[model samples]
Target: YRVGKAPVPPRTSVPFDPAIFDATSSTFYSALSNVDFRIGAGNAGAVAVRFRVAQHGYLRHVDFHIGSGLAGVYQAGNEFENLRFFGGRYGIMSEKTSPAWQFTLIDSEFQGQRNAAIREHEVDLTLVNVAIRDTPVGIEIDRGYSDSLWGKDVRFENVSRAGVIVSAENSVFTQIGFDNAVASNTPTFVRFRDSGKTVAGAGPRYRVSDFSYGLKLAGLGTIGDYATDIQMAPLARMPARRTPAIRAMPPVRDWANAHDLGVKGDDTTDDTAALQRAIDTHRVLYLPVGRYRVTDTIKLRPDSVLISLHPSLTHLYLPDETPAYMGVGGPKALLQSAKGGNAVVSGLGLWTGGVNPRATALLWKAGEASMVNDVKIQGGGGTLLTKGSPIGFGDPRARFDGQHPSIWVTDGGGGTFAAIWSPNTLASAGFHVSNTKTPGHVYELSAEHHYRAEIVLDNVENWEFLAPQTEQEVRDGVDAIST
Candidate 1:
């Protein structure tokens, strides 16, 4: 008998029949054909496909099984091997598949395995634009004045700490004004350091417009540390113009013809009393360019006269033969008045032809209200002659016997003398004031002197010896003399 052929089984289960299944089901079968036959399509959807693997091991076939849905419906056998899978790995086939029975391996193990190897990827992107604004704050530029770009004016605040070096070639702060009515107690400008240190580099070159009053560097820091470094031209180029409220005082004439009395130019008559008479008239007494011999001490009373030396080339000589001819005695001569009086003596050269140790060129008695401006007291010959008595009219024994000074004020009260030039050796004190309740109120002494009484020297040049009394000495003297 011929070997009997086993009857051929049906192509596939009912759900997986190629003739009955649409292209979706056909494609799904084709994609899963490589799976083992032991895993049936009945449980295809029930099996789980893990994307993440455990440590030290690749995925094993045993961990994979048929999932539910269409994967579970079809059994895995020879009949299913010829089938195709598409769409979700093994569920359905897409209509887009070709007529050559082509199928998509989408959602399949091979497709996922191919894509899993890729890691780094690239993509394109874009960007956009944006902007911002700012406002200035208010700050004080000087005392009683503040600046704000938004509110008042543009001004830099305390720039000393900002480490900014500001330099203006020709630029300036124009129309900068301030109010003087602000209480004097309030600082006009704060000084970071000592006086004159803040603006030390340049002379007064900077000019402020609309601020007629002078601009003073109010601080004592290095010039570089100033908020601004200004190189100012002369005032003639750009005259300062300020509102009347803050305008500077008018210019004062050094000599006016309206209030002057003429005097002889020869060293013959004692013009001291005559000059004093003219001074008492509240007018200037003019000493023509000549020597006017002084005989007796001439005192200047309060509100009496302002003796003005003519600007012409003339000299008023204090003859060597005479004693102290002009003794400015009275409280007015010392520029001191219990009722607040003022006097000024200006533009005269007070010279003593004799170098008498006893002869003082100008004798200032106690309690005088006087100021000597632009006056020169020179020792003519350098011979120490004894003629005029010591300054204080008290006993001559009371005077210090050492080199008597060219200008001496004794039995003093508060007084002032300014703008005086004395180039002579003072045997005792160049300028002395003693024996008063409040003696030695002199300020701004400029001269070459051996000893200087209590005085504040401002802008003074070439002082050989300035023996200003110490604070303790001043206090002790005040106490001693007041008693």
Candidate 2:
């Protein structure tokens, strides 16, 4: 290499090999921008892209197509924007322990195949208008770090498990929406970290529910300050306590129509294919008042408006093994949205034909931007559930054997479940919301004869049960709702 006073031509391309950029390697320095890297799936490196402040390097507009098990490593003072990560285990993984590691992501989208969308370990991070989808977990921050995680206008969609699992202190999350999280073992909007102050908007405020006692007390964290505007909605405004209404069916108007697929809802024939076709084809999928047998689980899309002609007439029948089959070796949801979007499924009677003790009647893995309004979930009231069998504990195989929840809401935040009436005698809890950071409201939820708890909320920061007449039994535990 020769030294020159003339303007040096920039290195237009560079091989993104992990071995060359290891911690022990030379201090690699570059001011590279507008670079496209095709990191092959065969690369078995632990980290995909790592930058060191010692080199004073910055990467921008760098599109990466990484293979499996690789993560985009970042350090402090690095500015990344318009960066797209596809098919990687961890979309963006920052393990910087330095307080000066101020990493910022703007206008980026992380489409991970599995694992966390962004895993930051002891790093001061900020994400503005970033979208993460098709991943299992989103934005996991572990190990106490310097300063809070500042995020605004961020969206997490179609994740399998948790939306944002953080253990960081002083984290600030605002204008964030987590959508379409698939229901799985541990579904949480935010988990682990009990520290940090959160300021949210007014019209949409949160409430704290459920608690833990005994040895878990020491491990329990605080739900920090939530600054909101005045004149918010009342904590408990009871909905109308009348019988289910039969609304007049409206004329077809939405673009996506299910009727074009010949879905005649006769219980004998399998309407799964036709129904699924309609759901895939139209934005607004309509179902007439008829008993439809769905052999397979109907997957929902984003921004889908599924309407039932009448709550009493529009019915969906599930097989003997419902979500129980999900617990077993089969896919169980009668209807589900794996990649959660703003889907509204209204006015339908979902019933299980047989007593498959390990099944789930209705599962919402989609984000909180979805809804299941005016829908009834029922389990076949048989001697099997009433006889009272042994409940399993501490075992994954026996997780839902003798008991199962009628409805399971996971991950998807900002969705509503209004006027949900489930009077069927079930084995487990009536409703279960797990691992959701910001869960939408539930209005007029009526259910009875649950063997276990009525509703179970785990790892939730805030929730509201707006049923004044619908008395609920609170679990006897320590008062764990204080900062």
Candidate 3:
């Protein structure tokens, strides 16, 4: 067994044997680099090639057969570079520890496998300049693991089903490219679990030529694309808007100074109930100068106005791990109006805890004649002043997860939205509008640098996009916008 970095001998034509190379007590190897264990085609699971990275083990420039032997690369906190994994049913499955095993791959390629290229379970995996092609599924991050998966410059070419299936949280994919392949399933390129909050960045030349859907989100977060060709149909517009009732409301109370209701605008305190109290009692709920923490979703009743008293003095924050909004009785959003109503939300900055991908700043389901004005849902980029102070100015932690959104409007319609700025969200469509009874006017809407397409409108009636700006050209599914 070699301890330190040494020039290892090449096993050019030696058939990989499991009994001799197994890292048991009798036959143990410390490290292996620049070794080639090439095996030809054989039956399924006919041979087994196994290697374990002990305390300080490293594997580099190792070659193996494609879809032949049961090759298990088990390691703990190890580095693998320049490794070529050829065809295999389960090409190089990781038998590492759950939630602790860490592996780094650099300049690696897994090609022509019948089954998955790389299957990992509860491992913190990082891939740099890695390519996986001509396989059924490219990479599968198994479930029941809550760790990180980071990849940079990864390419997937001519895969059958899914390119990548992520079941973990806090995953980041940068500059991923897909060429000349059909991801048959809708959202076939990348599919995430409900808890997966991923940040993906693709260059302008990147294209998913034939995929059912580019990204499918089950949780909250955002997807940002600098400029990529996601060739799919747009989302289908709803037939008609199910408009909600419009109600008149009285004036609101001063939330910060309302000590009796225990509405403290301190960043430390959970002000969800106090703010709800203000909403129920007054027609309008005004926010004062302070950082307010909201843990759960605050469902708005009919006929109310929630506005920031001073833009510089108010910061509404939704912390990490905030449950996503699924349905009527499902997860809650920061500010949601499930039942469409006549409400107004304006003049504030909504920030997230930079964790949960399912956290949405504002979800408005308002009826006709509603208005949302001068609101900024600040994520990774953009500067917001609260109470004469610049909050989250140049703060790198101000980013949003790919599944979270700045604003989502559904069901009801006929609302006017003006001056909404949502930027740098990881992978969400900045302003998503669906199924409105009547179309409304949107002015000065900026949804820039989102991972997915920006400003998605579905089944909207006579809705006008006035001075709407986005970072990339919006691409839709086949039946999305071709009316």
Candidate 4:
């Protein structure tokens, strides 16, 4: 695989031969993307396609389904993008537990799921730029809410029972919304089964249109618009994704491993010198699952790649009693980004050891050509800081109002700090996006438990934010990432 660049394989549709196509059990962070799997009405299995245990993954441009049983996708949290499932018994039957803790479907299609296009329960659900058609029930929130649900710009066609179903037996939802929905052939847009007391005044910012054959639901009132009120693409049509041409990839053994270089990740030993030695020796680094305690910063080589597939499993921390790297407030991070620029760091967790309020968690000055995605930061004053436009002064040269990218942009000299697809991070502030002159890019921020604002924006413009959710929580008694 190429370093610092994401793999954009050729867009091909192939039959789902479980032996050859399914890589579900290959690796923890394996990406099954860039293809389509069609099941045209043949009896498949109870489950057609699902990555069983992917905590931080992004599955893009892949279609999978079964003719019988549950024929939809079972993914949550920054999982699906540009996906489609048609000619199946059901659309999406997902829960809150496996794969991830949240259900996020962006820019996808669900067709002919005669029963329910989406059967959601437990986790926080996010649906943006989605289309559901030819289904009896479109989006069925049949179960209780373990978290929140936020959606926008969903197109529906030929939906019979309702565009959405919110069960009354479910407990009170903390947050729920489905704004600006466009539908066709859908009667009774949002039907509240049983009583309506659970979601009556829940402040749901949802509306199902098509203006109805006559009227709308009970206590929730007349939902949606005239369906034709907004202009949108036809139902069940997923836009084609443009990507770079496919290239040959080398095997994994060529890269360097920190574990092989005599660095122990027991969290008790100060792995500073050995870690520094590993960094000095290798150009590409891989740290396996384990927590490594460091007392000093380990510098990085130029244009290197550091990967830890499981962020929740691999951690790098600083000891609580370790002396501050420098002066006032300990302005250093445990794992410092390389001044070398053009680095790729993904799938790792970094936390300031102990509950040191003045401790700084992370500092990203890896130049503009660098990227840090799927990395979790916890327990510090400055949880994360992306210092410049692309490691320099703001270059308001272009706007970022472009298509959603599954991976971090490599060629452009812009700073990208993506933390785990759509996972709800608990911090003092959700997003402290500031001091940039870049424009025309879109972001999907799903952060919660902020001391101040879910999104604290300052000195930026022309960017887009989609289906954002914010709440308040404090981690480790220290309010990190305060805007």
Best by TM-score: 4
Worst 10 residues of 1 by lDDT: 123-132
By descending lDDT, how would the candidates be arranged? 3, 2, 4, 1
The local distance difference test score of model 2 is 0.53
Candidate 4 TM-score, C-alpha based: 0.54
RMSD of each: 47.5, 24.5, 22.2, 13.7
Global Cα lDDT for candidate 1: 0.29
Local error of candidate 2 at residue 174 (angstroms): 37
Model 1 misplaced regions, further than 4 Å: 1-262, 268-270, 281-283, 309-316, 323-341, 365-369, 380-403, 439-441, 449-483
- Per-residue CA lDDT of model 3 for 141-207, tens digit only, reads 6675444455544666666666777563343322233323222222356655554533231321233
TM values, all candidates: 0.35, 0.41, 0.42, 0.54
Clashes of 3: 52
Indicate the worst ten consecutive residues by lDDT in candidate 2.
207-216
Stretches of candidate 3 off by over 4 Å are 1-260, 323-331, 384-401, 472-483
Q: Stretches of candidate 4 above 4 Å error?
A: 1-45, 48-63, 73-87, 94-102, 106-124, 127-254, 273-283, 298-302, 325-330, 338-342, 355-358, 366-370, 379-431, 439-455, 462-469, 474-483
**1-483 in candidate 4: lDDT tens per residue?**
112322332233364332332122112344556676656544555555565333345666677655665665654444456778775667677666342345556678888886888787764677767888888887777644433556666766777777767653334443455655666666556665554422111111223422211122344655532121212223443233322111112246856788889988866667889988887777678888887777766666556667776665677766544566433452455565554366667677665543222334444445554556566553222132121101111223211111111122221223445434322232234344454444322333444433344455556554445434333334421342323
Per-candidate Cα lDDT values, in order, are 0.29, 0.53, 0.55, 0.51
Instruction: Give lDDT tens digits, candidate 2, residues 47-74.
Output: 5565644112345567777775477554
